[model samples]
Target: QGLRRAAKVQAGQKVLVIGAGGGVGTFAVQLAKAFGADVTGVCSTKKTDLVRSIGADDVIDYTREDFADRPRRYDLILDIAGGRSLSHLRRALDPRGTLVIVGSERGGRWAQGVDRALRAAMLSPFVSQKLRMLVSTENEEDLQLLGKLIEGGKITPVVDRTFSLSEVPEAIEYLRGGHACGKVVITE
Candidate 1:
């Protein structure tokens, strides 16, 4: 929804998905490609291969390279669970591009990433680049679209691991350790 509705992804446009190996990032990468955009993914070194295998045209290892330092700029950028400063992200975004922040787990408990989103909203009117925050509201309409996309083989969810119902604590720990390459599931 963020890509299609918010960023208004169009064919052949360069789209970058930060944190491309995570749960939401993996799907964002696939969905952007399915929408006919050229997708670039940013991830840690350990997840580079997974990102590429999922159809990213380019994968940047954030450990070794800063995407903002590159000469190329993206028409749309989805910052998923990333903590990069707004200025840093803008350097890699086209002047007229759209930047969408999705579910960042940064900041303290009180503000809890809302600070960045609020700042973005405040700064948007003055900037040429559109800086927006995506707060996903689940609805059947979008779910149907996702179902069709999945049925058509345009997108595939990557499940990194699954834990039984009794192993919830272990599952949570695994996710907190930041070792998951994709979605971690707790099965009943």
Candidate 2:
């Protein structure tokens, strides 16, 4: 609901996907492409080509410079890492742009994303631009839709590494290291 409402994406708007090489980010880039938007994916140097191969029109290497420093504005900014502050994010947004704060987990042993989402909700009421916390739910229809998109070649999932189900603890540790370029799935 948040994505559909905030994005209201027309056929030709520009979307900036921060952390576009991660799990949700990979999908965000592809879906934005399928939605007919010109997608710019921001990631580290190593993931630049991966971002483009997944369907982003452009890829920004975040390790080299600050994306928020650029004068170029975006109609929609989907911030997944939550590394950038709200003020910094607003600077890159168009006047009435939508900001979707997706999973901001920094892989802390204790969770960090929930705090950011709470703050965004409190600050949103006074803001002119749409500031939203994306609380996603497991829905059969949405899953089906995603599957269809995958089958249609409009979207693809990037799994960086897979760990055996018995090694779930090790998988969590690896994710906490934050070096994985994509998702670390536990396979049965």
Candidate 3:
């Protein structure tokens, strides 16, 4: 919904997915391709191949290269990593593009990473680009659509690791470690 509804992604548009190897990033890369957008993914060195294999037209290794330094600009940028500043992200976005900040893990306890989103809202009107934050809500219509996509083989989930129900604490720790290449599941 963030890609289609918020960013208004169109076919043939250049899309960039930051943190393109993690849970939401993995899905974003595939979904962007499914939407017929030319997708570029930014991830660590180890996840480049995974990102590419998942249908990213270009994969940037953030460890070795800065995507903002490149000449390429994106029509839509999905920032899931939540590490960079709005100014830094805008450098890679087109003048009239949309920047959708999905989620953030860094912020003070008061705002809990929502400060960036709030700042984006405050700065949006003054800027040419559409700087917005996504607040997604689940609905049966969207869920059914996603189910169809999954059933039709348009989207494939990547599960990096699975732990038993008893190991929930360890699973949480592993996710907190930020080393998961994809979703970490806790199963019975």
C-alpha TM-score for every candidate? 0.96, 0.89, 0.97
Q: Per-residue lDDT of 28-121 in model 1, one digit per residue for the tens?
A: 9999999999999999999999999999999999999999999999999999866788899999999999999887565645677687776787
Across 95-150, the per-residue lDDT of candidate 3 in tens digits comes to: 99999999766655668878888898889999999999999998898789778889
TM-score sort, best first: 3, 1, 2
Between 1 and 3, whose TM-score is larger? Answer: 3
Two-way lDDT contest, 1 vs 3, winner: 3
lDDT of each: 0.91, 0.81, 0.92
**Candidate 2 lDDT, tens digit per residue, 1-188?**
33454557666888999988887788888888888999999999989989989889988999997878888889889988667878888899887888888875554344555666667678888988777878777878878878899999888778999999999999999987766776789889
lDDT of 2: 0.81
Better of 2 and 3 by lDDT: 3
Error of 2 at 188 (Å): 3.1
Judging by TM-score, tell me the better candidate of 2 and 3: 3
Q: Give candidate 3 regions above 4 Å deviation.
A: none
